[model samples]
Target chain A: MKIVLIGSGNIATHMGKAFMHTGHQIVQVYSRTLANAQALAKLLNSTGTDSLEAVVDHADLYLLAVSDAVIPEVAAQLPQELEGLVVHASGATHIDVLDKFRHAGVIYPIQTFSKSVDLELTETPFAVEAREPADTSTLITFMSAISNRVFEGSSEQRMAMHLAAVFANNFSNALFQVAYDLLAQHDLPFDLIRPIILQTAEKVQNNEPRAVQTGPASRNDQNTINKHLQFISSNPDWQSIYQKISDLIVKRKENNSEN
Target chain B: MKIVLIGSGNIATHMGKAFMHTGHQIVQVYSRTLANAQALAKLLNSTGTDSLEAVVDHADLYLLAVSDAVIPEVAAQLPQELEGLVVHASGATHIDVLDKFRHAGVIYPIQTFSKSVDLELTETPFAVEAREPADTSTLITFMSAISNRVFEGSSEQRMAMHLAAVFANNFSNALFQVAYDLLAQHDLPFDLIRPIILQTAEKVQNNEPRAVQTGPASRNDQNTINKHLQFISSNPDWQSIYQKISDLIVKRKENNSEN
Candidate 1:
């Protein structure tokens, strides 16, 4: 398949590099910034263009690898009625945003990416969705060719999965930031908690998170909870966040008990 | 070292099993429930006794592996100071809780344990602390025999580490429950987000989480935030949790930028 990347962000850079080992051909790259476009284009030995009108219609797939808000605007400005499928690599945006194109689909790679750090994308799950059934199958097949964990889901599921990832990955990462910051204030190394953090993540790999919940919150130990709360009293926002999460755990425990 | 575990819960059971291969001898196992005590004692080929009066003074280490609230009560009932060190395997409890004894210390295993799963105890981090410097050294040496990751910390640092862990492990586990339940409502499998969760944890192993934060909240993208909140509006508590955590990320980002 021939491909054209429409943005030079993390997703675009990763996908461009991943396609390097595959049978696909990357023909053109486009970005609002020419240098960003040229940087990724140089990796694929492809042409770079800052003008949306200059996007080539020669590729089999043109990925709108841009932000969610501008996906519609970018799709609107692209050359109309292209011969290839037009897909966006967004977890939140709907496929109808590209309705002007005869071919519309989505291929959301469900993992964090940084250009400096190469990824084992072959193991990353790609959520593929399309407006038409045949288009969905085509995207699934292409994704399967490069990765082992490819699944076809509804646009709603893809969005829900994204939301869940926010809690599972993004929000949890924020909590980690809280831990890191608190430890730093105490003059303790983040390395002190690394092993325990690894074990916490490893636990959920085979067990349900609710079943394996631990700590003062899960145990409903008010003494420890209050102790922890008092310890962080100086940070009112952190105390609130602590209380909310702890309450969620306690409430869920009660719900399970009633059932 | 000669050892006796005072409680037959997850901590006692895991530590009892971990000590079986070492040079240490578990002289006795004590539990409020006779059967529970005998069950763990049977694993170590040691005796099980329910009465504190029957506890032998032959062991060099007495581990009060029980709950935070009952630590004082349990410590009060234990046989009066012999020639052994009395320590509690609690993350939140202070070492002075055993003030009635000659030797008081803490050996906190900073990992969640389930009776059904066997762990690689050697890799687990044990935070050793004590009321006296000599006792602290003893704990550091004993813990080092069973695990490679052992460090001596002040009681305050241990308590702070426990508080940090509430945010790192316990609160994050609660967040994972939120994600799991949300996905179940959408008829999505938890497996879909497993890789992302693992990657989220792995990134922080080498990088500060604040530096690698990602998500709509980190981006301060109100559009997607409003969309997610609307989708989960039926559950007010979840909506609140979502708002608080997202606000936290946005605020932290603002702080870093200001710095």
Candidate 2:
């Protein structure tokens, strides 16, 4: 498959490498910065350009791995005569955002990408949504070449999944930040808590999170809760966050019991 | 080291097995229930009894692996004539609670214990806070036989670590539960977000969570935040939680910019 890669960020870097490895031809790499585009293009052994006008639509697929806010603007700037399939690698944006082009779709990689890590694309699930049936198959076959799991979802379902990721991944990571902050404030080594964190994560691999919830909050040990409240009294905002989450845990337990 | 593990509960079950595997002789097992004590004793090839008075202090170490609330009452019942170190494997209880004994200390296993999983005690950290240097060394060697990491920490420090564990592990798991609940309310499969949850946990392993935070909350995208709030508004409690956490993240980002 002939593909044109857009954006030169973390996701773009990994996606470009994977596509190249799968014997796909990367026609050109486009980025706002010349150096960024050149860097990926050199890796792919392809042409590179900074101008949106230089984007050639001669390839079978054009992947926009740019940020959510910039996708529509970039699409609008593309030449109307460009002939190819277009896809955006965004979780939150709708498919209609690319409606200006004859063929539009989404090819979202449902994994956290870092440049240093070795990613097994087969483990990463791809959520593909297209404006047309033919476009869907093109994206599906392209993604399936790199990943073992490919599912077709509507724009609304993808939006909900994206929102849900915020709670499951983003919010959970924020809570970890709070924990790190609380520990550092007390001159505690964050490494000491690593085992517990890993084990907690491993628990969910087999069972439900609600089944594995523990601590003073889940135990309803008011004495310990009061002591923790005293400890975090100085940071009122964090203290409030702590209290709300604890209360929510207790309430969930109650709901589970009634059920 | 010769040891007698008291209370054949979750911690004792794992600790007793680990001690036996490390070639330490468990002289006796004591529990409130004779069957529970005997069950652990049989595993360790030792005698078992129900009464705390029946506890014969023949070993060099006595590990009281029991719940926090029962520690004082159990310690008070132990015979004063007993020799060797006496330690309770608790995260929150103070070591001085066993001050009546000549040798007293703590051995807190930082990981959550369940009966189904065979716990690898070699990686488990034992937080030791003893009344004397000799008792500390005795515990260090005994626990070190089974665990690689052992540190001297006061009851207050252990309590703080325990609280932090709640935030990092227990409370974090509860947040996952909240996500599950929200999805279930909308008749969505909890499986759809599993990949996101796994990635969220993996993100913190390499980066400080404060730096890796993402989502509508992290982006300070009011439109999406307001939409999520409206979606959960039927449940006022969840809506308030969503608001508080979102506001906290936004505030943290602001503080970061100012710095």
Candidate 3:
């Protein structure tokens, strides 16, 4: 399968490598910055271009791995008569953003990608959606070649999944940052909490997160909560976060008990 | 070393098993309830009792593995002239809570423990603190037998570490619970986000968490943030959390740029 990668960002670099590893031909790579396109193309042994007109129109797939805000602008740049299945690798953007193409779809790899990190794509789940049944099957085949986990879902489900990912990955990491900063303020090394962070993530794999939740908030220990709130009083932002999240946990526990 | 475990809760159970595994002699287990103590004692091949007076006085160490609120009460119950080094396995409670003892210390393992989950304690870091130099060395040797990672700090440092753990372990798990609940509401399987969670945690081991943070919040993508806020409008608690955390992330990012 000949593929044209539409961006040279972190997601694009990872998806491009995964596609190439699966024996697919990356015929062209495009980026607004010529250097990045050329760098990725050099590694993939593909043509690199900064202009959408230079994209190979006859490739089997055109993967738009750009940011959510740029999906429309990038899609508008493609030749209106291009002959390929056009797909965007965004969880938040709706597939309708690709409606300019005759054949449009989405192949959202539901994992955070970092250019320096070598991720194992085989187990990473891909959420696929296409305007037509045949296109959906093509996406399934394309994605299955790179990953073992693939599921069909609508834009609503994908967006919901993206929101959940934010909570699980981004928001959780933000909370970790909070912990890191707190420890740093006290001259405590971040290593002090690394084991606990790893263990907390490991526990959720087999147990329900709610069942495994442990802390003052879960126990409704107001005294400790008040002490923590007082400790972070200097930082109003953290104070609000601590209070809000604690309240949410306590409320959820109460609701569960009432049920 | 002869040891007496003075609680039958989750931490006590895990600590008892770890001590027994290291070939230490768990001479007695004491709890407010005889049955609870006996249940754990039976597994460690030791005596169990409800009365504090029945606790073995000549043990090499007395481990107070009770709740933070009950630490003082339990410490008061112990015979004032007891001959063993006394330690409390608590993060929030200070070593001073056991001031009644001639020799007091702390053996706070910095991980969330559950009796159902078999944790590998050898890699889990233990934070040790003691009033005397010899007792600190004794505590270090005992902790080193069960874990390769051990550090010494003051009671103030332990409380701070405990607060950090709440953020790293408890608060992060709460964020996960939010994601789990969100996924459940959408009729999506929790498995969809499992890989992402594991990868997110793994990324932090090698990178600064602040550098690795990604999401609508970190990106300051207000468009997606507003969309998510609208999606969760029915749940005000989630809405407030979404707003507050996003605000915090954006504020932190802006602060970073200024610096």
**Which regions of candidate 2 deviate over 4 angstroms?**
A80-82, B182-196, B235-238
B-chain TM-scores per prediction: 0.96, 0.91, 0.98
What fraction of the reference interface contacts is present in each model, in order?
Answer: 0.78, 0.53, 0.76
Report the candidate with higher lDDT, 2 versus 3.
3
Where model 1 places Cα greater than 4 Å from the true spot, the runs are none
- Per-residue lDDT, model 3, residue A142, is 80
lDDT of each: 0.87, 0.80, 0.89
RMSDs, each prediction? 1.3, 2.8, 1.3
The DockQ value obtained for model 3 is: 0.79
Clashing pairs in 1: none
Q: Which run of 10 residues does model 1 chain A get worst, by summed lDDT?
A: A110-119
Q: What is the TM-score of chain B in candidate 1?
A: 0.96
Tens-digit lDDT string for candidate 2 (B112-159): 777766667777667888999887877787678788888887787887
What 10-residue stretch in candidate 1 chain B is worst by lDDT? Answer: B109-118
Give the range of the ten consecutive residues with the poorest summed lDDT in model 3 chain B: B90-99
Taking the tens digit of each residue's C-alpha lDDT, what string does model 3 give over B1-259?
8999999988989989989999998999999999999999999999899999888779989999887778888899889998999999887777788888899999988899888888889888898999999999999988998899998988777778888889888888888888888888889988988989899889998887999888888888888898899889998888888898888899999999999
